[model samples]
Structure formats: structure tokens, C-alpha cells
Target: MDPAAEAARRLEADPSMLLCGPLSVLHAVLDVVVRAYGEAAETVRAALDRLEDRVLAALACRPHRGHPLPGARGP
Candidate 1:
């Protein structure tokens, strides 16, 4: 569930949260937000890793160029 909904559910399910003060509520919300961000970051990192692996594999399959004379002072 989304952070707001989760926080609301927590508050409703546990009335003591309201008596703890606003900071407690804020902490609960922030905790959810932080966890969501961490999950998203991990997803992105895994995708990038897969992409890098594919690129490296493709490059490894290609033949190397033996000639280079575009702007060289060849002997």
C-alpha cells in the first residue's frame, strides 16, 4: 500500500500512536517513504547491472579493428 494509506491504517489500528504525539506519526510516515525509496533504488541498480552485462557481452562478441589512421602519424 502507499505510504499515506499505510500510515493511516497504522494509526487507526493502534490508537496509542495518536497519544505519542505528531512526531511519532511523522516518523511512521517517513519510515514508509524511506523504505519505498530504498526499494526503488534497488530496482534501478539491478536494471543497470543487467544492462551493463548485456552491453559487455555484446562488445565481447565483436571483432576488434586493426587499422587506425583517422588522425594518426603512422610510421
Candidate 2:
């Protein structure tokens, strides 16, 4: 599954757990910081931040460089 889909599955499977993990510590600190600086916004900026690196690293992809298919062009 794709990263977005996986994340959605995670959120659906266990929302509280997804948001309440150790990552929540950083989120909580951001929440406090936002409140402190009085930033106005509909959603937390952190949510907009891309966690793609961590997410993708967790979901390792299949390597496809060496195993070329039959009739495939060669360099």
C-alpha cells in the first residue's frame, strides 16, 4: 500500500494510538508553543508537515534495479 493509504489505515485502525504515540510528545509541545505565540490557524501546522521520510522508511519498498524482466532493454 502507498504511504498515504497506510497512514489512513493506521488512523482508522487505531486513531488514539496513532496520535497518542511518543510522537504525541512533540505534538503536545507544538500545541503549547502555538498557544504561547498565539498563532491562528484552522489546523495544526505540524499536521501539514511531511512525515514522508519516516513513514516511507517504516514501509520499505521492493528493490527493482537488478532483476530486469525478459525482453527488457539493457544498457
Candidate 3:
């Protein structure tokens, strides 16, 4: 984001996190694309989105170890 516009955009849009605007735009495009593919496609797309979100959550929670993340520990 352009630094100059950041303040103004934040004031007007009031995004909860810095990612809200971009994620909102992506969500719109995804909605259209998924709806076009019908119910089964929508289900698959939602599942993929959920999985992607989980992966992102995991990545965000852990520290990056040696550039690539370390392997998960065994139970």
C-alpha cells in the first residue's frame, strides 16, 4: 500500500486489520467464481479456503525457522 494513502484509506474503510481491503476484494472475486461453478464446486472451494486459512493460521502462529519452517514434532 502507498504510505500516503494508507491513513486516508484506513479512516474511510476502517479495516480491522491491514489485510481487510485486499481480502475483501479477493472474497468478492471468489464469491463470483465459486457461485458460477454450482453447489458442489462451492463446497470444494469453501473447503479449500478453510484449509488455506488453517495453514495460514499455523504459519502465523509459529516462528519461521531457518527460512523454511521446521518439521512438526511427533506426538
Candidate 4:
């Protein structure tokens, strides 16, 4: 399941979560949020890495060019 849904399910499944006091409940919620953020960051990093590899590969396959004026003669 997705992170948000999973986090909610976890919070809901544990009835004791509410009895732990505001601070403890807050900590649990924050922990879930942080984990979700970390997962999202990893996904973004992987996508960027794939994009960079494709761009580099395309550049590598391009033909090299010589100097533009190599064949020019004095006017």
C-alpha cells in the first residue's frame, strides 16, 4: 500500500496510540511523515539518476565536429 494509506492504517489499528499522551502521539505521526518523505526522496533520486544516464548516453553517441573555419581560405 502507499505510504499515506499505510500510515493511516497503522495509526488506526493501534487504539493505544491515543492513550500515549499528546507528545507520544505527535511523535508517532511525525515518524510516519518522515518515513514517507524519505521514501519519496528515494523515488525522486532514482528517477533523476535514470534521466541523467539517458542524457549522457545520448550526448556520447553524437558525432564530433571539427573547427568551423577548418576549410576556409582568405577572402
Please give the CA lDDT of all the candidate structures: 0.89, 0.57, 0.64, 0.77
lDDT of 4 by residue, 1-75 (tens): 354566557768886776767765566667888887898899999999999999999989999765558778756
lDDT of 4 at 10: 71
What value does the lDDT take at residue 39 in candidate 3? 73
Q: In model 3, state the lDDT of residue 23.
A: 67
Where model 3 places Cα greater than 4 Å from the true spot, the runs are: 1-37, 68-75
Tell me each candidate's TM-score.
Answer: 0.73, 0.25, 0.38, 0.61
Which is the better candidate, 3 or 4, if ranked by TM-score? Answer: 4
Evaluate residue 60 in candidate 4 and report its C-alpha lDDT on the 0 to 100 scale: 93
**Candidate 1: deviation at residue 3, Å?**
0.6
Which digits, one per residue and each the tens of the lDDT, describe model 3 over residues 21-73? 67655554555455556876878999999999999999999987754447856
Question: Could you tell me which residue pairs clash in candidate 4?
Answer: none
- How high a TM-score does candidate 2 get? 0.25
How well does candidate 1 match the true structure, expressed as C-alpha RMSD? 2.8
Location of the lowest summed lDDT over 10 successive residues in candidate 1: 65-74
What is the RMSD of candidate 4? 5.6
Best-fitting candidate, measured by TM-score? 1
Query: What's the count of clashing pairs in each model shown?
Result: 0, 0, 0, 0
